[model samples]
Target chain A: MREDHHDQPHAPDHPMTEFEWRVDAVQALLIEKGVITADEVRRAVEEMDARTPAQGARVVARAWVDPAFKARLLADAKATIAEIGITVGFDATIVAVENTEKVHHAVVCTLCSCYPRGLLGYPPDWYKSLNYRSRAVVEPRSVLSEFGLELRSDVEVRVLDSTADMRYLVIPVRPAGTEGMSEEELADLVTRDSMIGVAQARTPALR
Target chain B: MTRVHDRGGWPGSGPIDKSEHDLSWWEKRTDAIASLLMSPEKRVMRVDELRRAIEDMEPARYEQSRYYAKWLHAIETIMAEKGVLTREEIDRKVRELSARR
Candidate 1:
């Protein structure tokens, strides 16, 4: 939901809506009832703020170099991600799907804004969009092309639709010509878009 | 069964907005509330209940609002259902806050 909802009016464009007031109203109610402390709410915001795509980049870079780790990540994504210190929210499971030369994997939460928040941080604005939710499922190739990512025709495009309980992380193929790069350096080539399978990993020149 | 929240692959949907935006102050609070409510240890509200609450809104409202607005609305609805707070209290709080501004 973080993206600019172009179809919707902005709060700045007008006064706060009824629901906007409700957000503040509800928080005040919770604080007064002792259901949740103000500190906890502050910390929750801090927790999300602390996460970044860098965490996901680190995971992707490690997967690129460590065949063993990639195997584990593919087998049991949540656990393997935890081994590298990525912890998803309790209500969800993170699934890692790899893209190879023969098949490309793209992710979409057709239902809602489900995402691998533990790794890539908050879902990007576009990911929560109604346009993306609908388009990515049936027209992934076209959608990817919109992002300027044109896949080879030979590669089969697979769209992984995320659910509330199970989210997906697309492990894009490492770009060629970076044979000796360290994991840290390799991390630099991974972008948030690439991890979501909207774009390819950065080539050496891009890094 | 196809609610407005079930938005996958709907033809003639608006164009996707790829631009990212900063979390506004209230948006941050909404996110925090959602996370806090979903925590198992807290047991304040369940995601299923929240989703249902969101879907229960009129289609026009659903179409007009953004994502976090849905969460905030759902949380307000579900929390009231669970006896955590009443709608009256929320409205009074809103009025009180507005008067100060």
Candidate 2:
């Protein structure tokens, strides 16, 4: 007999996958190429999730402290956001709706999820749901009611529709008694719903 | 090691095991380009149009493949490279690409 193992077959080493193997491979290659470190990639993803500017908290905080800036934001959301170095006009048309105690504003992308992520970071879970889409336009009051926000009947509900081009974000009026509060403290009170015009911004109770 | 005699069974007579096809660099690049098409604001292409565009861009090897299958793969590949596309830049790029010959 020939002293060879050529007649034997070996199992294949790799199995083909139908998933996004290429993306993972590219990230690995980027790490290897030193273009971006593994830590950098992780941090970037975390930053994206942690505080997307779409909330417009920065704008709200500035508005709380500066009346002139607040006037600018109310006049033009796109220009105001740009002033803060957050690009807002390229993708979705951002409109700034002011919410006061007497009259509240609520925004909805009836056609799609047109949100200002550049200012707010990320859209909340409910913003992307069908209930929000269907109810926001037809019954804004009912939807807001569910979120524990009941508007007085006298208050006009100005619901802004965000289509492909015109995206809107609500600029909530600064809560009372929050005077002398730091920008960070004001930002903390600016919830995602407050920016969407669904609910009023809440402040800490006095001790 | 012990030597063995031929048993009637032949070696390598079974079907050739298919090689795992890793996406090439060009394929990945094409995917990155395609990701620009998906944005929240842009008027997205219809299924047929998307299929046509992908087919036109694909290499000659994949030309005869099923249109829907390949296009689905392209979209899936795009979603994987999530950071590759932004709503604004992609919309502009898509418009520019669409205007091209």
Best by lDDT: 1
Residues B1-101, model 1: lDDT tens digits: 67888887787976677899987777877988888988988977888888889888899998788888888889878888888888899889889866754
Q: What is the TM-score of chain A in candidate 1?
A: 0.88
Q: Give the CA lDDT, 0 to 100, for residue A74 in model 1.
A: 88
| DockQ per candidate | 0.60, 0.03
Measured by DockQ, the strongest candidate is: 1
> Candidate 1 regions off by >4 Å?
A1-20
* lDDT for position B96 in model 2: 43
List ranges where model 2 is wrong by over 4 Å.
A1-47, A50-55, B1-101
Q: Model 2 chain B, TM?
A: 0.30
Q: What is the per-residue lDDT of model 2 for residues B11-38, given as tens digits with 9 covering 90 to 100?
A: 2222212223433333333233232343
Go through the candidates in order and give the C-alpha RMSD of each one to the true structure: 5.3, 19.5
Error of 2 at A139 (Å): 1.3
